[model samples]
Target: MCSEGKTTPKIVRGEGGYVLEDVPHLIDYLPDLPTYPNPLQDNPAYSVVNQYFVDVNDNVAQKIVVHKSSPRGMLFRRAGPHQRVCFESDEVHACIVTCGGLCPGLNTAIGEIVCGLYGMYVVRKVLGIEGGYRGFYSSNTTNLTQKSVNDIHKRGGTILCTSRGGHDTLKIVDSIEDRGINQVYIIGGDGTQKGASVIFEEIQRRGLKVAVAGIPKMIDNDIVVIDQSSGFDTAVEEAQRAINAAHVEAESIENGIGVVKLMGRYSGFIAMYATLASRDVDCCLIPGSPFRLEGKGELLEFIEKRLKENGHMVIVVAEGAGQDPTVESMRSVDHQDASGNKLLLDVGLWLSQKITDHFTRNKKMHINLKYIDPTYMIRAIPRNASDNIYCTLLAHSAIHGAMAGYTGFTVGPVNGRHAYIPFHRITGVQNVVVTDRMWARLLSSTNQPSFLSSKDVEDAKKGATDAAVGRGE
Candidate 1:
């Protein structure tokens, strides 16, 4: 039988599976659905939707009823007007918190956020969440005000205290929702930013109106988007200071050689920048450089020659410098330090040991190996003026971005310039090794060590050979 409405084939259940019967196409048979009346037709929500309609009250006397369905069904009535009433109160029961490793300018960032919100924005009820995400889930919080943040900017560590672990994003969101917090400012590194973004997304998904902002913080300065991470400049400055100290010690000790290791696990920016700043480093070993496991014997031979010829050696090695095999082996050994912290496989220490062993084999040579680890010292110093200013700008930019409803973003300086970039832009950006051009420039620079020269290598070999001959028994 032909269909009565439209002209197309429609599916019909038959004795078998299904059969196609003649029917109308969708466009020919479809009927329009009724439009729902807006609940806030007389309020701001009506204006926001920007729809034009005649008032039905005038026709009500005719005894007619209008039936319609909303996009959200009966729940459409709850989509109220976007009023500023929630933010009008003087008591802002909100808070700011920081978590993770100590990054430079952390305290300053926190202080600026609190002061900006409370003093300028007039948000008074501010609290600090201690121990990071843990503090968010745990029952640990401290009230903060303008006065409380005044001295905190000068501090190095976190004012609210910090813990490495605790609550996940959903848990923190649930806790904050329960506490009636309308907004939160999270100051932290990449991990913390990820957590904050997840929480923000979850809150939105749950239909809650809460704003969250993240300030980029990391000593590694590896966070993408910002020109530089918060603690990077400070770390570089501290490294330079330590390098300067090492140079002075080397000169004072007369014929003394010192090997100092700087922190830069996957990238050698710290070592490179420090080498550039400190003009006396004899040799700087960084990841991605020409120095590798295959070249270790040659490097040790070169170092011995430099010590014998110059009477003093100064080497700056990145903490991440070394061959993959040695580093991997060290990791497998599960070494631990006195503080219960995992003792990282230090490439500088390994290189130093190799040099020491090489010099020892040459009994005639009197070379002393002084290994100075500046990792802790560099990260613990007070932030320099440049870093503090940069961090303040980053924090301000982050807050402003949040206020503007930007999400999944990072604020920091890039290529020595202050800029903000999307977090997703660098979500999987690889940390490449230092390029060969940079390596060549560093090698040729008068400020850095010329230890790879032929003369230096020859002298080291001679020293080792002589020592071996003298040790003949």
Candidate 2:
């Protein structure tokens, strides 16, 4: 183990900005665990590669841009194949489970994991836990094979079939121990990953020789510490069709307003990117930044101004935008889903009705408004080319980390470099639009006002900082 890879694993440098926290390893508890040659060494695929294995000391810097006086900043363990592994191929039995909502690359992620374990290490007996975490004890599992998941990447949704909030840590671990499963691959969002972290602690406390690996999945792009979520690009790309359609609908009529709601519960990456990509958006709203509905220089005023200027305008709002209960009694009923995520009101419907009522009752003018909600459609499709390649890399990285005895961690890219991120660093928090260059660029592209005030900017900045600090970014 490296010097900084202590039990606490904390390293600080340069005015407390730089941090290095190593991921948990099997050696931390079971110090006598022996090492074996990595199975990739014998495979012909990586046989000729000279600089293949990643060093134990190799770390990816979290911050790319820092002052000259600043230290190297936070660093993460660089992810890839290791020259040595803690587990032999024949002794490994892996199980995969996909939890939370559906994302575009779920099938691709599942397929890649099965294929990577089966083809690279020749580890057979991979099982898929169907119906989310409950399937572990529900006896609703399926055997996974390379041939069984060969073409699953071309399909949409997860082949394992997913649900949310069935995380019974004790029962799940009991099932794992009974089945003799050693490696556990869990794919899901923040809540699901939080569950994974708890499971890891339980397994570690019981002194089980189990490796718990996580693959972060969220189309919302909210989970912090990673560059972006798995299906973010696909969601943003698929949103264009709705944006274009809204633009056409708005432009086709007099006093036209097209409202397209996208999927962004807490973060607004999808809505912002979709609005930026589709130049037809006159206004964009997200949950990170607050806005007023009816007032001087408010959202209604902006809509009216845009309509007067262009004769037709488009507004793009994330599903989670304007969720404040004080915002026109929009959220009268506050309910949560099985995963504990708040069930959001249809902002598109509420916003469209507000615009219609404001025009008809207040202004005594007729307006044509069209609402397009493509939230589920965007996430339910197959992964695009970008996500396909990314999911493959993520799957491979997770396999390598688990084989190298790195447990209780999730795998993702930090500042364009893939690294193993500890589960505690990423779960229960989120990454949101920081109202920095990206938000400014989106506002400039849409020609929209700040909508709220300097408070939103400050709050967004503070949220970004808090997330960075929480994730050790």
Candidate 3:
């Protein structure tokens, strides 16, 4: 029987032992009753955050349902007790792969997974799949151990390397079967998780029992339902240096406009937080909160007023902001990356030129503008202390999920707790900045003219309030 796009195979006892009752569901691996009962119950190392681990039969309360169309949710429960893995340590072959763009905590997350598998699980056949899915078919596998990854967390990039393409699900599943890979840990963003979910589906269709898990790696904090993705804190912290530079440039010159473009292809948390941290921003633009190019109480008017009042201005714009109006020229020749994200038009340069043209056309005061794009610098830095802890939690939770026979899920913090979120729930959505909640606060803090209309503000506030109520906060 198929329900919710997944095959629901019932277990039955046969001459060959427990087997899937449906003939169509016959696979190489069969589910067995969990043994080594209470394996970690008395383990000394289970002292810290032991509540995260749960018995396989222990159903949890507090189900968070999301997206009625997809109809997926997570049960908040303990996801740990390192000793109680689903696969036999000496027999299981586990592989890990990283995909998509680099994030600040990729290495930290990789290190935690390697250490947990080698040290905690004592898994003898731990392998790293290099360059993402492409590594599966190619001869790019590497042997991993706790000793090999001991200090990798102190670094920035993933030691396993990562890429975005080669999403051939059938071929990937074939490689998994050929390599005897029972557990796969995928570290990536939405696209990578989607790929993992597809691979899981293929494995299930072929009646294979390989477990696939994900740890979210979105630096923009755009993955839906996740409170914070890894690298956001570090990105925000590193963006501050750029913001400080912009502030100094603006302050030192007459009518200088320091324009900064930050990463946030679909969301604007980085730009919004950086603006708040700088505390000297005259105008801020984000993808979620679009502003008029030239109108009363719009972006240009606010910048002009700020220049007249303070003789200098600073503006922070998310890379995706004003796509409809400002990016028309760049869109004609735009290309997509292997992960399928569009090459974003240079919004910062476009905005700076607009400011210069406005001053030239109107014969207003001459303007000095500096545009800065600090995306690469921010992405290359090591994880901050806060993100380091977050990555560790996600990694540990992912390992727990995989060892417990859970698949097609991404480990993330939800409602301030680390939990398992089904990849289907986060497949095509983004956690955009809540205008009523965050943008309102930003506007008030900056004392800038209201860019959002009264009706829009009211709706945003209502949405925020309803979300808060749902969270019981």
| Model 1 clash number | 14
Tens digit of per-residue lDDT, candidate 2, span 248-299: 9999999889999998887788998998888889999988778888789999
Candidate 2's C-alpha lDDT?
0.87
Compared with the true structure, what per-residue lDDT tens digits does model 3 show for residues 212-239? 8888898898877667779999999999
TM-score of each: 0.70, 0.94, 0.85
Cα lDDT of model 3 overall?
0.75
TM-score of 2: 0.94
The whole-model C-alpha lDDT of candidate 1 against the native structure comes to 0.59
Sort by TM-score, top down from the best? 2, 3, 1
Q: Model 1 Cα displacement at 93 (Å)?
A: 4.0
Report the number of backbone clashes for model 2. 0
Task: Give the per-residue lDDT digits (tens) of candidate 1, residues 234-262.
Answer: 89888877777777777676567778888
What lDDT would each prediction earn against the true structure?
0.59, 0.87, 0.75
What's the number of clashes in each of the models? 14, 0, 3
TM-score of 1: 0.70
List candidate 2 segments past 4 Å from native.
Answer: 1-19, 325-331
